[model samples]
Structure formats: C-alpha cells, structure tokens
Target chain A: MFDYLQYVRQENFPHIWCAGCGDGIVLKALIRTMDKLGLSQDETVMVSGIGCSSRTPGYVDINTLHTTHGRAIAFATGVKIANPDLNVIVVTGDGDATAIGGNHFIHAARRNIDLTVLLYNNYIYGMTGGQCSPTTPRGANASTAQHGNLEPAFNISGLAIAAGASFVARGDAYHVKKLETLIGKALQKKGFSLVEVVSPCPTAFGRRNKMASPVKMMEQLRDTVVSVEKWEKMTGEERKGRFRTGILRDIEKPEFTAEYAKLIEKMRPEE
Target chain B: MSNDRPGKVRMMQGNQACAEGAIAAGCRFFAGYPITPSSEIAENLSVMLPRLGGKFIQMEDEMAAMGAIIGAALTGQKSLTATSGPGFSLKQETKGYASMAEVPCVIVNVMRGGPSTGMPTLPAQMDVQQARWGAHGDRGVIALTAKSAQETYEQTIRAFNLAERYMTPVILLIDEITGHTTEKVIIPDASDIEIVHRKKPDKDPENYLPYRFTDDCIPTLAPFGTGYRYNVTGLCHNETGFPTNDSNEIQCLIERLTRKIEIYEDDIIRNNELMLEDAEIGVFAYGSVARTAQAAVRICREEGIKAGLLEPTVLWPFPTKAVLAMAQKVRAIVVPELNLGQMAREVSLASQCSVPVHKLGRVDGSPIPPQQLVEKIREVV
Candidate 1:
C-alpha cells in the first residue's frame, strides 16, 4: 500500500460510490501511478466532464476543474495551451468522452496534444441513474432500455488506437497493480495516451441487473477479460461475448504540446 | 460623442477596433471561428494578442469557439470570441450558460445576412433580436453597436468592461459592412487606456464560495484551480453554485441574472446623440449601417431638414432613454438596419405615444447607402 489515501477523501471513504464501484479502484490506481512517477503535485492539472467517475479530480487535491459535460478534453486543450508546462489529464466517463464529446476526443487525439485521457468504462451511464450509455452492452437492462439495449457498444480502445492515439491500453479495475502500471506507463508515454479502465458500477449496472458484488465483480472481470496476446491465440468461440483487454498499441507520432512549444520558440523567440 | 469631448482618436474599422478594444480591456485569450466581417477581429487579435503574450486559439466550431473563451475566462483569462450571424446563432446555448453562470466574456457578433446559411459573406442587422432573445431564456444581454470604426473600438472596450464588471457575456453587434470596411487606426501604447479586470475572491481558497454575491448582486468570479471549490452549472445555481432545481433558488438566480442587467440601466447602456440638440426627426441606426445614417443626417442638414443620428453603442438595455428623449423632439424615427427590422421593433417598443418607427433595411447582401438613408430621413423628418 503506497499510501493511496493521500489521493482519496477518506471522510468520503464510504463514498456515495457504492460497493463494486470500480471508480474507486481506478481512482486508487491513478493515485498509485502518480506516486510511482513522482509527478509534481504543483504542476499537475486534472480536468473532468460530468459523470460519476468524472468526480475523481475533486478528491486528488491537485489543480482540478470539473468542467461542463462532454467538454473536458476541449477545456484541457485550453489549459494545456495556456500553461504548456503543467501535466494535463482529462478524466472522463464513457458517455462523457465517447458520446457527446466524441468529436473533441477524436480531434484532440488526432492532434496528438500532450493530453492523457483516463476513460472510466463502467458500461452504463452511472450518474443520473442507470441510463443507456454509448458503451452499454448490446443487450442490457438500462433505464432507457426496458426490454434491452439494442445498439452495439463502442470499442473505445480500438477507437483510440485507430484515431491516432500514440499509446492505447485497456485494463479492468480488478487488477489494481497491473492497472496502475498501465496508467503510469500511459502518463510517461511522450504523446497522447489513453488508458480505458473497465470498472464495475455495482449500484447502477450491478444491483439493478443483479450482477456481482464488489468481490465477485472483480472475480467476473478477472474471469472474463483475457489479455490480447492470449486472446489472439484463443479460438473464435472462446472470444465470443468478450471484450479483450491489454496494451492494444504504443507508437509515437509527434507530441502536441512540445511541438507547439517548439514552434513558438522558433517562430516568436521573445520578439 | 455629442459632448464633442474627444477622448482618444484611432483610425480602425468597426471590427479591428473591436479587437483593439478587447486588447485594451485586457483580454488575453481569443478563440473564434472565421466568418465574414468578423474575421478581421480574429485576424488582428491573432496577430497582435500573441505579441503581448496573450493566447489565441481558433476553435473547431462556434460552440467550441464560445466554450473555449468561457473556459479561459474561468481560468482568469479575460477572454473573447468574434463570429458572424450563423456562428452567433450557434453560440447562443453557450452564451446562455455564460449568462446563467455569470462567466464574464465578451462576444462580438458581426451581423451578417441570413435566416439560414443565407449569407456567409454578406452583412445584415437581423441579428438584433437574435442577440437579445437568441439564447433560450429571458436573460438580459448587454449589447453595443458601432457606427464608425472608432466607435467600434471604443464600444468593444466598453463591452469587456461591462462584461467583467457585471459578470455577463456582452455582445458587440457589428454588421458585415463595418467589419470589412477598414479605416486607418493608430494603435495607442498600452498605457493610455483604463482596463477593468473581472473581480475575483479575495478570501483564501479555503473560505471561497464561487458565486457569492456582494451588495451589488454582482459577485466575484474565481478561476478554476484558484482553490475555489464551487461548481458552475447551466442549471439554476445558488451562491454556492451547486445545481438546485429549487424554485426559490431558481427565481433568485434568474431575477439576479436579469436585474443585475436591468437595474443598472443608466450605468450599463451607451449610445450617441448627434445634432439631436435641435432636430425634430431622428435617424436611429447601429454598426456600419449607422454610418449611412450619419451621412444621411449631413445630407438632410444640407437640405435644411431637422435630422439627427442616435448610434447606440449598447444594444440590449436598448438605449431606451435616447429613444424616448428623441421621441419627444422628433415626430418620427427612421431606423436603417442591414437586416429585416429587428432593432426597428425595439425602437417601436421604446417609442412614446406611437411615434412612427419606420424601418429601411437590406438583407440581400448589400448596404443601405447614405442616399437611401437620406431619403428615409427626409421623409420622416
């Protein structure tokens, strides 16, 4: 235990975030990663859009901005360009990043701005009660989907890898150490990095659907998610109904903030 | 300035003057979408602002355009964005959020021809009503009009002051013609201007409440990461700024949002009076269109017609006192806008005893010329 308590609100220890809420686990992982990297608390900025998981920044005691829903990346873009010195991270939920903010997320990744996007995927809209989010399972019992959800879920890691994200990884909150390693790796990677954490939302997605409790949710995640290398060796039937997880891609183009700072240095040069 | 007490003289277009005004008012961040007439403001800002170590970002959409400015402003950057008519329409929702959250920002809407994507490259005044009612609610907007390139400069400076002082989004209404029609302007050294900064919390981060109001009902704003642990939501928020759908909170917020503007009528609104000292008929106009009215006034004067020009620098507090004062002296008001009759209606509403408020506008991508304005002025006079 690397004293992850520094990044948590212990008074909010039994947080409104219920048991089996992977948000806490992912948040803990993020804190551990920050600690491992020894990132300066003074120079770190964490921004988030609206959602249950977007609330992570407020607990960390860093420079945090709880911005408008679906516009965390855009706000982070401004923050990065403004300072260019601070380590800017956008903490967004599945719906916040993938749905309403889809355009901004793609464009930011495409620009390869030195932004780290931590996307928490709990598979359902957790904040305003359980609603059908963009990442909800194809057939799930959500508020909007009485019978079942009809739309196919978005493969977020695949989308990030495709949209020119320099580093893309997927991990479940159940594997805290491995997840924290991925987060630290993503943070240290020299370009736009995304770590999609498939967390469990017991209150909304679990309780309503009679899914696993906290411990059993971790067990289900451990049982269901297979690493990409192992899944590549698995047969088609073995991979059915399973969302593969691992470091999907890691290749650099150009880092956004440094390049911009370079251009500014070269072009303007203090007049 | 009817008082003819010349303060500062600068040769600038209505649009370029707007950028200078924003700069003079200490705006450090500008994010905008390129549209006709308003592009110069963005262009000048991009060229000049960075020279002063200010930041400029060209956003992807008008929605993001406004959002970037609002965000930067919340970061304690005096920020602004300029766009034309269609882009102005796109910014309405965000502008509404700025009003509700009282995020101080100056938005320049260079009026262009359209109801749809009608005129991307032309000028219009139809956006007058849109500037007021464009956002969803009954929230009051502080708008200013520019006649000369010089007035555009001065009013744009005023727009920022009013915005920061009042903690609201102030709109600088310029027409496409004024935006494009350039004039020579001397960029004064930075020392010659009075700039007002948006007031922020003096209390330590631990004791700050983001939207706590002072006696003026105008509260100080705290930038993000400034240690103010408060939320700014589009929903009706109490002083602490958490979303409260409660009716009492809702009414108090809306009333303060509206009255903070409406109550400061004398201080917040601005316009001009030209030869109205002895005239019986007035030519009311704004932006570049007001120039034609100014020329028309001179023409009417040469022909011995009693005509004057009321160029409103502030649009939404609607310059009612000017209209009422002129209404007592003049039998009719000839309002020439670039669009169909938006500001003319406000003139009618503000008029006393059914004074004839006639509108002469051109929405077909052409300016209402001075001769045409002169004819309207003579007929009304």
Candidate 2:
C-alpha cells in the first residue's frame, strides 16, 4: 500500500483551506491518483505557481518547485528537459494557468511537452482575496466586480484540446473517484495533458453566490455538470445553466522531448 | 583555468579566442543566436562543443538561448550564450533569472552601436550601463572586459571561475573591434592551470535549501539531478529559493546578492598602467578602446607629450580607485571609445584632479586612428 499518511507532512495538515474548499478535495484526489498510478516518491516532481492551490508542492514528499506566479509551466518545462526521465506534474489554479500564465500554458500544450497540468478551477482568485479570475462564471460576484463579472469563463478543457494537448479531461473535486481517474489518465498521456478540476471556493466564491457551504457547492456541481454527449443532446436553454464534464478531448501525438531528441539524432549520425 | 589542451598557438580574432577560452574553461553546453560581431563566438562554439561530447543549440531567439544555457548548466555542465545589441536586450529577463537563482554560466556580449540595430558590424560600448542595470530588479552582475585576444582567453576562464565562486552569471563584455580583430594567442594544456568549482551542499537531500547562504554570502550550488530536492526561482526569495512576498525577505535577498559581489570588489577588479610612472598626461579606456589608447599613448610620448594609458580589463567594478589615485597626478585625461563617450563619463566622475578630459572617437565601423588619439592627447597636454 502506498500510504497517503506517509507521503504528507503531518504538521502542515488540516490545511488552511476552508471546509468544503475544492482545493483540499483536489489535493486529496491528486494524492490518491499518484498512489494508484504507482509513482514513487523519488521519481516524481511537482511544480506550482502562486495561488491557494499552488501550495500543493509544499506538503508533497516528492521533489517540488514553488515558483513565481503564473510561470509554473515554464519552470516545469525546464525541469523536464533537464532530466527527461523524471515524471513532471504541475499544480495551478484557474487564475494561475489561464490568466498570467496563459501564454506559457498554450505554447507548452501546442509544442506537446510531456507533462501533466492540473488546473483547479475554483472560478476566483482565492489566495489573493477573490479578485475576478479568468474562469469566473458570467455574472459571478467578486471583489473586483461588485456589479458581477461581465467576462465569459474559459472552457478550459476545450482550450487545452484546441491548443493541441494530447489528453484533456474535466472533473469536479466533489467527485472523488472520477477526479482520481482523470488525474491518472493525464499522468499516463504521452504529451501535454490537462485535468481541469472544477473545485469549490466556499470562502470567496460560494458564500458570495449564496452557495455558502461545501454541501451546497457539491450539490450545484452535481446538478450543473452534464456529460459531453448529453450536452450535445440537451437543448440550448438546458445548456445555458450547465458546464460539460468528462473527457473533452484526447489526442495521440509525438511528445516535445522525444521529437527533439529524434531531430538531434538525425543531424548527428555519430550519436 | 586549466590548460587541458597543450601547445596550441593560433592567430584568431578576439571573439574566436573567447570561444577557445570557453572550451578551455570546460564549457560543454552552448545555446545562442547569431548577432553582429558576436556571431563568431556561437559559430566557433557550435563547431567545437559537438566534438567534445557536449550539445550546441542554435536557438530561435536570445531569450530561449539564455533559458537553454541555464537549463544546460543546471546539469553540472559549464554553459554559455553570446549575442549583441538587440539579441542582448532579449536576454535580460533570463539573465535576471540566472542572477536570482545563482546559476553559473557565461554570457558574452560583443557590443555594437545604437539603441537598436545601430551598427551591426561596427563597435560600440553603449552597454556599459546596461551591463550593470540591464536585468530587471535589484541584483549584482559580474562584468569582465577583454582588451586583447590573449586576455580574451584569460578573462573567459576568470568569468567562469568568478561565476562558480560566487554562483552567479558573469558577463564578458567585448566590443566588436576586439571580437573581430586578429591577434596572436597561445593555448596551454589543461593540467597547467587551476579550475574552480562551486562548493556544493554536504547536507542530505531532504535538508538542502537551494538558496542557502553562508556568512560570506555565497550559496552552495547543487547541480540539478543530483537527487537534491531544492527549488530555484526568479522571484524574490528567502534563502530557500522559493518565492516570497514578504518585504523583509525581499530586502534580505537583494542585499545578500549585491553584497556578495560588492564585498569582493578587490578580488573581482583587473587593470593595468602602461608607462604611468613618468607620465604627466593619462588616457583612461577599456576593452578594445584601451588597445587604441595604448597606441595613442606611445604616439604621444614620441611627439614630446608625456602620457600613459590606464587599461581597465575588468570593466564594471570599473577600476575607479586606480583611476582616482592616478587622476591627481596627470595634468590631463584622454578617453577614446568606439561609442561616442561611454567610458569617458566614468573617467571624469572618478578623477579628483581638475584635468582637461578629451574624447577621440567613432560611432562608425572604424577604430579611432592612432594619429587622431595622439593629437587629442597632445591638445589636452
């Protein structure tokens, strides 16, 4: 048995995350997934940007890099290339990946770098006191927008798939088993992979939206998420209040690392 | 500073000589984009590194080139990147990253003219200020200037050692003239010289902090992939190398980074005085400009104007003390630069004497003629 208790630093636990906080749930799902996949402590590396979710690296037993806000992918790309054998994983929040780090995330996906990116979509900037993030749902109330957000949230799974990620999936941190499986799939993918874990932000996002508790947020997630095939079958009116769940896209392509190595070998026959 | 290769004397441009210097310094990884007078460094490195079981990459741009060098260096290899003007401008962010993260790498800039694309093949020293302040944020940079093809080799080795010793990036500043002008350089065997390696952490992997600093302020460098679990970041960090927004932590980090270099200023500076003992007039210059100043001093002396040249081989640290001490004795100071007047400003600032300072120059592709420099010296005399 790969013990979760053994892998985590006990003193840091009962983490600062609020009750029903999707970040806590996502962390649990990730831990379970890594254990299930049989990735040992030493072979793995976790990297993160600045956010409530980015604190994921601090508690993990594996090698970790806690970098500048929004540049986790860039640093992870460097780490992966420097040692191609290490299993690289990125933990970021919605604001961390899609806003400031959007350029790096898109380029890394398009280039098909072999790495897993777990974007916790809590729909608001939690650690920085709930400014509007890139994925704040339409009309969501945030500190920056007391009048409610006017911007449309990104379909993160769709964005990653369109940007040429080899595997893309969506999961709600409320769905424990599903979240774990999605993470496992991303870890096993040969190229860029993103698992958008739609997490609950009860402290800032939920309380303001009248979904004040984890129970209420989980109920909303359960009601709003529709499978992609069912989403297609649903009427336009039905689609307006819901978000799509399950695998949005999965592709097969040569990863960034292997392809670069191939080019090097071709030019240098002696190698 | 090893003479790993024996009995090799070649007539090579200063830029190519620097490439050979990098090779002799144990640089096995080079990633750079070709630009201006610095193109020869990348071209030579591309030809040489592959033969030594190392990798050489021609990156798409200078930003990536800098990132590549840092990534390569993290693997315990000596790495370098070369660029000029526009390309050098693109590398500032990563250079700051190298500074904050304390990566040991060599950056060679063969400066050309202008704000942007001023003189592609011509010489300029406009980047003297940029060498000190180019990278964003508060940090210390190790800048070394080379005056000849011979010093180009020696300075290249010194750059790596200082970088290793201090755990920071060292900029080798060479103008286009020194980069392109041919000179006689002798290469000795690797066994003949001492090479410095950064002290690594002795603690267990779990206990190692990436940015751990000693009382001397130098951090132990643990080359990546040694199973050491330490993080490196570009953000202002505490001694552990993880990003921190605390004001005190930020202050401590910047203070320590700069103090590490400023404290070692004496050991980091290099310069020379040519016939200063009996001279009444002085010429202050650096890099390739110093070479022409030496010639000008000789020409002025023959014309009955007693003068000497002060050559600054280690530019930033500036050798200001030497200039200030010599300033009180000389009646006049002459500065000749490839740019309009970069180093002349420093000479004027450091001189305590009320000496009349004059500049002999060119922003064009040509060096300041010896006759013109001699005339400038005579006028000041």
Question: Using lDDT as the measure, which candidate wins?
Answer: 2
lDDT of 1 by residue, B125-180 (tens): 87888888888886878988876676677677888888888899998888777777
Q: Clashing pairs in model 1?
A: B11-B184, B11-B185, B125-B339, B143-B315, B144-B313, B145-B313, B280-B330
C-alpha lDDT (0 to 100) for residue B73 of candidate 1 = 78
Worst 10 residues of 1 chain B by lDDT: B1-10
Q: Kindly report which residue stretches of model 1 are placed more than 4 angstroms away from their true locations once superposed.
A: A1-21, A31-44, A55-63, A126-131, A139-150, A201-219, A269-271, B1-14, B225-230, B245-250, B352-354, B378-381
Positional deviation of residue A153's Cα in model 1 after best superposition, in angstroms = 3.2
lDDT of 2 at B46: 71
For model 2 chain B, the run of ten residues with the poorest summed lDDT: B1-10
What C-alpha RMSD does candidate 1 show over the true interface residues after superposing them? 3.2
* Global local distance difference test of model 1: 0.80
Docking class of 1: acceptable
Assess chain B of each prediction and give its TM-score. 0.93, 0.94
Give residue B74's error in model 2 in angstroms. 3.5
Tell me the tens digit of each residue's lDDT in model 2 across A104-141: 68877887889999999999999888899989988989
